[model samples]
Target: MHDDRHAPRKGAIPTHALKAAQEIVVLKWRRTSFKRLDGSIDVLDDDWSLSIGGRSLARIYLLNGGPQDGRWAWFVQVFPEGTPGNGGVGVDDDGRAAREACESLLPPAIQQALADGRKSETN
Candidate 1:
């Protein structure tokens, strides 16, 4: 019998790479909170992850922000999970406008992480 421990769990993104991709992947929301330890307490948001074939590609969150015209909510810190990249792709207005932004962002982010991992393996 095959073990199911390695199988992806709900709201959990596999940080480890998988053998192959099987279907249309998406980002799943996870509980998020922000605390201050000398930093701003206003930083808070809901977190989400994009996983493919049980492997995490990127992580994003809707950040708390002030009103600016018709915008307020911001999706910032688009970074690869597990290793290498520790910064964001860029900040964008959350909700409808941000959807396509992430769609375009995921592929390249995952590819870069995978490449970085491979490079590290050779060193």
Candidate 2:
């Protein structure tokens, strides 16, 4: 919760943070066919990893069957070879929170690349 009386004037977590609304965050994630390290394409609706479009970005996953069902998971540099990743807590019933969580974990460069990719596609 943001303490309106003492929170920083320029930056603060909004009161609606708990709801995790799509409007609160501005990230565009398209469903792309995820290619495994073996180069096999697995295009499952529940598979949230959709190539963040950058150098060695993590592959974000939406948990469906595991104990952490409705949760999200990610790992850095999940391209050819990767690094350790992060996971989301609580349940994300609609995946909006997972998308927001994934966006938060993404590197700035990848996010920028995604923006740039959108621009080029429109041209």
Candidate 3:
């Protein structure tokens, strides 16, 4: 009796929030694996989201399942302001909205690094 939904089997990794923006969110999650009498397979699917002023900004879907060390994972899609083509709400007013969102999520060190990178690129 194996419950795939809530049960914690082997190779199951916990999901955690890593970064977020007004329209985007990044998350870190662990991969899961299962073994049966016939063979074994890996299951790696996770979801994340971002919010702004109590409103959801974006949704992130991740997939993490593969052979080898099992550390290989990938981000499947990043839905900003909900699903596209559905009249989704986004910060089209000014690019500042996006920049502010990014700043809020990123740490001071990372922000400085990004700023320096941008400066170097321009110079």
Candidate 4:
């Protein structure tokens, strides 16, 4: 019998190179508007992927609100690398991917805002 724990899971890709690239692949979709308690909201469909260590490490999906004009929700997927059975870090990895993807999808001005947020957190 195969020990699933020891076996490398499918779809696992090394992400070191992709992370080093510092460039993300961005996919954009049409925007949608909705009503919110606070006000009206617009959501955009944007997806992004990061390559690391010559492999694809993670992918992100962004849904940002308009009217409010900010991020409302995000979806992220992380592939396995350097881990047994291609396990995933789920919430943390997804959150990071989402944030990064969202930034990639933003306009120049909004992208600046995302960058600033990152800087503030680090400092």
After the best TM-score superposition of candidate 1, give how far the Cα of residue 60 lies from its true spot, in angstroms.
2.3
Candidate 2 wrong stretches, greater than 4 Å: 1-40, 52-56, 74-93, 115-123
| Candidate 1 structure quality by residue, lDDT tens digits, 85-121 | 4334545565545444554544454544445544656
lDDT of 2: 0.46
Candidate 4 C-alpha error for residue 93, in Å: 17
Give candidate 3's whole-model lDDT: 0.34
Write candidate 3's Cα lDDT for 1-123 as tens digits.
766765433322211211232113222222333456778664535433433323333333332443422222222122222221222232322334434443444333334444555565678
**Which window of ten consecutive residues has the lowest lDDT sum in model 2?**
78-87
List runs of model 3 lying over 4 Å from the truth. Answer: 1-92
With a 3 Å backbone cut-off (N, CA, C), the pairs that clash in candidate 3 are 13-30
Ranking of predictions according to TM-score: 2, 1, 4, 3
Which stretches in model 4 have alpha-carbon errors above 4 Å?
A: 14-48, 53-56, 59-69, 79-123
| Most lDDT-accurate candidate | 2
Candidate 1 TM-score over all chains jointly = 0.35
Instruction: Please say which candidate is ahead in lDDT: 2 or 4.
Output: 2
Write down the RMSD of candidate 4 (Cα, Å).
12.4
